[model samples]
Target: MATDDGMRLAYYIVLLVVIGGAMLFELSGRGGKALRQLVLWVVIFAGAAFAAELWMNDGLGGRQTITSEGRIEIPASRDGHFHLTARLNGTDVRFIVDTGASSIALGPADARRIGIDPDDLAYVGSAMTANGQVQTAPVTIDELAIGDIVDRNVRAWVIDGELDGSLLGMSYLRTFARVSFENDLLVLER
Candidate 1:
């Protein structure tokens, strides 16, 4: 094993030994109670670790599903926001569906990923965001696709300020024949 892996294993082993020794000392006379407490602690730690793993893997966002009839269903994330992954210029980009946003907004990182250079764009437009007015650069997305649906020459803006992630706003949602939220799920029909 690599040095780092070996060291980590050693650290975990040491931790287990220390914790086990302490538990044994504290529960020297109570056999049944000690076993029950140990089981409870194990369950608690296991549950916490599982939750951390799920959060790190974005499992909490739930999964986006596409139907055979070309309908897209997005489940609300734990934070109560609908998020979906779409192809922007053939590059996978994660976006949060924001009804308040007037147009599709791309963060600088996502803009660059889709072959748009933020440095080359002219920040002539301004947007009123929650953080106040921010400079924006208008651009045309060569292609934007969600599941089997695709659109070309899509108008979007690159926000010249801090953005957690890209925003999929009304600009694209308007194309859907039907957009509705039911039971914490956002459904988009073409």
Candidate 2:
């Protein structure tokens, strides 16, 4: 996040310099054609500069910005998924926001990461997954936080089967007043 702010400041500084230079040239007896040419070059330079930043910031997407005012904006991953880093039980956990999922699903590895013992959890429940059916165990998250949004005692399931990572499902997402996708951004508002 600090890196993003620094990059933004640098971009603005460059933009200001370019604009100032163009204005100075325009004031120095530049004709309409010269003004037009300056404008075109400025546009091209700005586009290229932004393009370079985007390329450096994960193909122009991913958590490029975050707000403290009950809003979090995340850019789509290269794979086109809205993956976010959330605090689960005070630990940073990566999750893929899955609206189709009924509840937050944690893999065994993730469960352990959050201090839950998978061996002690009883896999009494089951869920129908793309890979047929998988056994699941109920678990409660002490706290889950995404940016300024936080929810306590959140219900989640620990899958006894294989999974790549934890899923942030409707159980947590529905708590938000709004969840939307615009362009390549995922906007979550309280």
Candidate 3:
């Protein structure tokens, strides 16, 4: 129920209308300055859209909180520990607070990600497992994260050597007091 100025209406229906409008305005100008500006704006907008998408999906964006410049403060977790997103050796991971473990246990794959050579750390010590006594190896993790919380120079132990990965044992959990688990989140109140 409308009249047109001979411009294609299909473009208007699907948001290509902006491009058409830009072109029309550009053509109307003898100097073509408007067209150049429109094109520049379109390019800039597209780039910004891509960048925003990447930032939102990336690891850095997931945990970063605007507490201050380059610092993310925990908003006082439930227990003594602050619950936040955690990554093991750059790999996305989920962990629960377990004070029972004497040292950090790495899933077979997690151990490899931390660059723990299976041969270097042998099963010198024994730790109790749900099933029974299990062999273990000594290793260290390059980094550990709980949400935006960062803990470095952490000690970890290798497990399931042939299988790969470890458990987030006391070695890493002891840093905080009384870890809390609620729903699908963990909070370290320290």
Candidate 4:
């Protein structure tokens, strides 16, 4: 989050500079083609600069930019359990990349959203929660995805009773080659 804010600030500063440069170009007295040509070039430069930032965020900017310091406040995707906005069956789902959770756990709502029939599953165990004990049932996510990442027939538990949300426990996090957190960006390398 901090990294994102830093990037926003940096971009804003860049925008201010671009505007100032444009104003200066407009004032540069060379009358006809020369001034118009210079103005066009400036616009092109600004557009390219912003486009590059977007590219970097999309992970297409390459590993060099990911590891580069001060390239963009794109939270260091270093090493940590990150809360990445993941895709699941073409829908967005929030998951906590937790290493502590014994098995993947899903909330009742999430289970329903994923096409699981809550009444059909059997409550097998009592899982401990931050609030207290909760019943857990065996369930499988037909499809689980994150960005371009996807996994099918993933094992997870549907807490029989109330649960705050689902957990992307070690079972899932372990599959990645590397999981890191730096600059507020959860970087996953697989």
Q: Mark the 10 consecutive residues where model 1 has the least summed lDDT.
A: 53-62
Question: Model 4, residue 106: displacement in angstroms?
Answer: 0.7
Q: How close is candidate 1 to the true structure, as a TM-score?
A: 0.73
In terms of lDDT, which candidate is stronger, 2 or 4?
A: 2
Summing lDDT over every window of 10 consecutive residues in candidate 3, give the lowest-scoring window. Answer: 1-10
Model 2, 112-134: lDDT tens digits are: 99999999998999998878899
**Which pairs clash inside model 4?**
75-183, 76-182, 76-183, 78-180, 78-181, 79-180, 79-181, 80-180, 80-181
Q: For candidate 4, lDDT tens digit of each residue in 53-132? A: 65645433222223222121123333333444555565566666676887888888877877777788889878888878
Q: Rate the local accuracy (lDDT) of all candidates.
A: 0.85, 0.83, 0.54, 0.66
Per-model root-mean-square deviation over C-alphas: 8.0, 8.3, 13.9, 10.4
Deviation (Å) of 142 in candidate 1: 0.9
Specify the highest-lDDT model's number.
Answer: 1
User: After superposing candidate 4, which stretches have Cα over 4 Å from the reference?
Assistant: 1-81
Whole-model lDDT, model 4: 0.66
> What lDDT is reached at residue 34 by model 3?
66
Q: Order the candidate numbers by TM-score, best to worst.
A: 1, 2, 4, 3
TM-score, predicted candidate 2 vs. hidden true structure: 0.68
Q: Which stretches of candidate 1 lie over 4 Å from their true place?
A: 1-49, 57-61
Any idea what lDDT model 1 has?
A: 0.85
